[model samples]
Target chain A: MDLQLIDQFAKNIIFEAGRRIRTAFTYDLVVETKSNANDLVTNIDRETELFLIEKIKSFDSTHKIIGEEGMGEKVDSLEGVVWIIDPIDGTMNFVKQHRHFMISIGIFVDGIGKLGYIFDVMREDLFYAIEGVGAWYNDSPLRKLQPVKIEEAVIGINASWVAPNRHIHHEKVIELVRKVRGTRSYGSAAMEIAFVVSGKLDAYVSMRLSPWDIGGGTIIAKEVGAIATNLRGEGFDFFHQDTFIIANPSIHQELLEKYIVQYD
Target chain B: MDLQLIDQFAKNIIFEAGRRIRTAFTYDLVVETKSNANDLVTNIDRETELFLIEKIKSFDSTHKIIGEEGMGEKVDSLEGVVWIIDPIDGTMNFVKQHRHFMISIGIFVDGIGKLGYIFDVMREDLFYAIEGVGAWYNDSPLRKLQPVKIEEAVIGINASWVAPNRHIHHEKVIELVRKVRGTRSYGSAAMEIAFVVSGKLDAYVSMRLSPWDIGGGTIIAKEVGAIATNLRGEGFDFFHQDTFIIANPSIHQELLEKYIVQYD
Candidate 1:
């Protein structure tokens, strides 16, 4: 498989998808609640997913596709050349803020990660990585994350983590909030993960993230020498929602051992 | 007082201050902790304050200035033409993320807000308001805020408010987080306030914000037909720090009554 050729092909499709999304913004968006109030889906999200899936199929009809909107092939397991796509990762933000949302795509071959892409549609920043090659932020190369002191490290975290919640020990999370240099909640997992890879955020913690939500970010994160794992310090399971902690190599373990507590 | 002239003058100085801040990014930053680890000050922050003060003083030496770095005259009261300046709001972001930080200036005469400005230095998006005139986002005019449902309203808030903290009832804050459409913590009060006025955020809440921290944002908020007051719905005290809630006119009262609980 010509990975370089595939990279170019996918990037073009991603940019085209982004164009359609921006075009949708010109008119009134048809938005509806999905699952719950926090989860929303706009007409753009569904349209973008279908566009990506169609583009992928035209390139290679044999490739399997799993999408956030479930617009394409029903993907149960990672088999063959599979593409996991989230046309609009931050749908709530898209429906409300009109910014901070992204288009994320992860490609795998026979259950192994191969290529990934994340695009900040509004900011027009594109980040991508190929296995054993490198990660690039637009035209510049992304440097490996430098170890930062936990005391001075800035964290991109969900505010709900510090509040009383069923996921983690809110108290432990609160302690981490005070001990860190500062806390930011951008309301987008893909964007926050992009920030971590770019060194804008030293770490990012999300109690629950879907495969489509983090699949692409985790791939870019790996090339930048950052770690994206579960609370158990294990690798990501690509088919289900689970806890996620992606951070600079130096602080990943400490964040897990000290702060992230699960009810065993 | 020719408020339009002052607005143009202040906006120009703000752009110059922003240029100096970008110049400092090319060199090493001299960072120091202020009241606590979370509170930080940098050489650029201090220098920018001095630069703005010097420019304002040259324009009118009688203009009393109160800056975050205390580089200007001691301002005991909001008398004469007082400039409340936070040369670099969100200094931690300036030092760490190198983004999201802003320069905020609020001008007052006889304790009445006359003109206000907030500049997102990196993004170069300048927001300013002239009393009884209007607010502008760059070259475009800002529209008055429309009422949004609390269930669908996105809020700009500090994460600490939801954590166990000294200021307000943390539990009540957690409830507010769940009730809103979304919660965003940008790490800068002024930027959050600008977001509120621009309608990117439906509301902004901060406990223990100083006069300089909120001075500029409150003025712009007022111009956009939003309300900025304490949790108790009282006016901001320009001389001291206290709880603050800036929101669209439709939901301000409900937010104070329904969620923000203060312990007696």
Candidate 2:
């Protein structure tokens, strides 16, 4: 496969989708609840997902597509060329703030990620990576990440983990929060991962996230020498919803071993 | 005091300072530890403070100034015209991320807030307000903030408040975190308050902050009908560091009554 060709095509589609999302922001949006009250879905999310699916299929009919808004195929296996799409990764942010959300798309071949793209729709920042080639933030190439101690690290984590919750021990997460230089929760998994890649955030930890949420960003982060794994310090399954901890290589293991304790 | 003239002068100075800050981002920053390792100060911070002081002095030499970088007078009273300046509100973020920091200036006349300005240095978003006039985001006038429920609100709070800390009860804050729809920590008190005024964030609570940190933002927030008070639900003293919770009026009283527990 021509990786460069695929990368260019992905960028074109993401930019076009971003343009539509920006236009939609000008009008009053119609939002509805999803699984829970906090989980919101807007008309723009569905429209953007459909737009991506149509463009992907038009580009290559044989390509299998999986989308968050249920506008694409529901394939059980990661077989052949597959496109994982999260039209608006932080739908809540899009519906509420109209900023900080992203359009993420990951192209995989037989379960191996090849090309990835995450566009900050409002900020016009395009983060993309080609496996074995490199990662780029817009037109500039990203440098290898430098190691940072946990004390000096600025992490991205939601307050949900630190509160009394069923997912993990709140105390341990709170301990970690105190130890870090600072903590941020942008409400966008894709943007958080992009922050790790851009060196804005040293790490990002979340109890549960869908494959589409971290799919594209994982590739870009890895290209910059960052590590992505489940909270158990195990490799992530791109096909399953699981706890995720993506961080700089120096502190990823330390955070997992010393801080994270799942409430199984 | 002519607040409109002062407001215009403050805007011009902030814009000039922001331009200088943007240029400084290209060069390597000189960071120094202040009070603690995590508490940082940079050369740009001092330089920016100096610039603002010069401008303020040129405009009105008799105007008292209290600044974060210690470039201003140590006035015992908020008499006559006083300009409270935080040259770089999020110093750690400025030294590290180079984006999330802001330039905050609050102009008060005889202990009464007359005008306020918070300039997002990198994003170039200037949020300003004039006493008895109205608040503005750049050129657009901000509308009165609509009330949001605790269950539907997005609050800006640092994780330190929910940890085992000396200022407040961790358990109560943890409970509040779970009840809120979402929580964000932007690492910049001024930006957080700006979020409250802009309706992006419904509230912001901080355990301990200096007058310079929340001074400008407090004016803008109040102009938009939001409330700014100490954690005890009392008025803020702009001369001392104190625990603060600035929020939309609907949830402000409830958060203080139910969540905040002073360690005394």
lDDT values for all models:
0.88, 0.88
Proportion of the native interface contacts kept in model 1: 0.68
Q: Where in model 1 is the C-alpha error above 4 Å?
A: none
Minimum summed lDDT over a 10-residue window in model 2 chain B is located at: B91-100
**Candidate 1 chain A: worst-modelled 10 consecutive residues by lDDT:** A90-99
lDDT of 2 by residue, A5-84 (tens): 87788898899899988988789899999899988999999999998889888988989998888888787878898999
RMSD of 2: 1.2
Candidate 1 local lDDT, A17-108, one digit each (tens): 88888888899999888898788888888889989988999999999998999898678888789999999988877876678899999999
Top TM-score prediction, candidate number:
2
Query: What is the per-residue lDDT of model 2 for residues B73-146, given as tens digits with 9 covering 90 to 100?
Result: 78778899989999998887787777889999898899998898999998999999997889999999999998
Instruction: Please give the interface root mean square deviation for model 1, in Å.
Output: 1.5
lDDT of 2 at B25: 83
- How would you encode candidate 1's per-residue C-alpha lDDT over B1-264 as one tens digit per residue? 787788879988999999999988999999888888788999899889989988998998899999999888767998789999999998888887788998999999999988889999998999989888899999999999887889889888777778877767888888888888788988899999988999989998887889999889888887999999988889998888888999989889988887776766
Clash list (residue pairs), candidate 2: none
lDDT for residue B155 in candidate 2, whole number 0-100: 90
Off by over 4 Å in 2: none
Q: How well does candidate 2 score on lDDT at residue A182?
A: 92
